[model samples]
Target: MTESQDLDLTPRDADDVSVGRKRLRNWLIMGTFTAVIGFVLFQALTSAAQFYYNVDEAVARRGELEDSTFRIQGTVTSEQAPDANGALIFTIAYGGVDTAVRHVGAEPSDLFEIGIPVVSEGHWEGDVFQSRQLLVKHSESYEAENPDRVEYDLDDTPGYVPDNTVE
Candidate 1:
């Protein structure tokens, strides 16, 4: 056979080259898709995660955390009243440190009051925490430990007297 015939590429060689190109394209597409999915999941998880801190820690780290949203836990130490924009303003204390919070959005549950522990979620606005969500921390053990102390309206449960009621 001549040198030209010996070096000539066959139809089978062309088919193999086409198959190799297709495989590389598929791999590239799959890699791009996997990368995109990974990036989306990372962003979703990171954005949903929030750092929790006590009032004292939050106060101490105010400079570092001023721009980030986080959760602060403390006992309500002041009266809760509405501000000019109808936001509830109050003070919370933990570990002898106090921080003021201005809560906007939905009102907290009835359990929210002075002395109650609450976790507020928001970022700092100046020296005050601008909370968009407030969660009251309460114990379920109160009803279990003191069944008789549970207060019920006289109309709702007739003849059931609460422990605080005068005889």
Candidate 2:
């Protein structure tokens, strides 16, 4: 008869009950960290988003024009004349005041006549935005993209060549 005596298995460790509390603390820490990271990522994405603003809108919101890219839409204001290189000189008035824009490149589109809107890309330097590219804003209309409408006249009839043809 091996001794089969009672072993008092009571109060093994008083802090053993704290496991549940520790888990709750861990969960709270993890959750708070996740929430903070998620919020920061959302704000960065929002701030880096593309912004399309008119000249007036840009002028009114100079604070919004920090070191961020922007697409400003406005009519190319007529100037005294073109520059020496034939690049058009004009002012893009966003709001009541106009800032000079020097477009030293190809001529504006045929439709880029005065009073027609054009979109320019640039960052604001002070109260002025130095445009790097100009794009004419087209009206809301669609045209069929048939081959006939294409400007190029190319031979699309594929005359197949063997793999050995290109040496």
Best by lDDT: 1
- The lDDT, on a scale of 0 to 1, for candidate 2 is 0.62
Tens-digit per-residue lDDT, 30-125, candidate 2: 999999999998987875465468776777777866857777776555444775766565665434445556565556667765445578777777
Error of 2 at 166 (Å): 59
Where does model 1 exceed 4 Å of error? 1-51, 144-167
> Would you list the clashing residue pairs of candidate 1?
none
lDDT of 1 by residue, 7-101 (tens): 85656656878989989999999999999999998987886565478888998999998678899988776655586899998887777677789
For model 1, how big is the CA root-mean-square deviation? 10.5
Q: Clashing pairs in model 2? A: 55-94, 56-94, 56-95
Q: Candidate 2, 59: how far from true, in Å?
A: 1.4
> What's the distance in Å from true for residue 83, model 1?
1.7
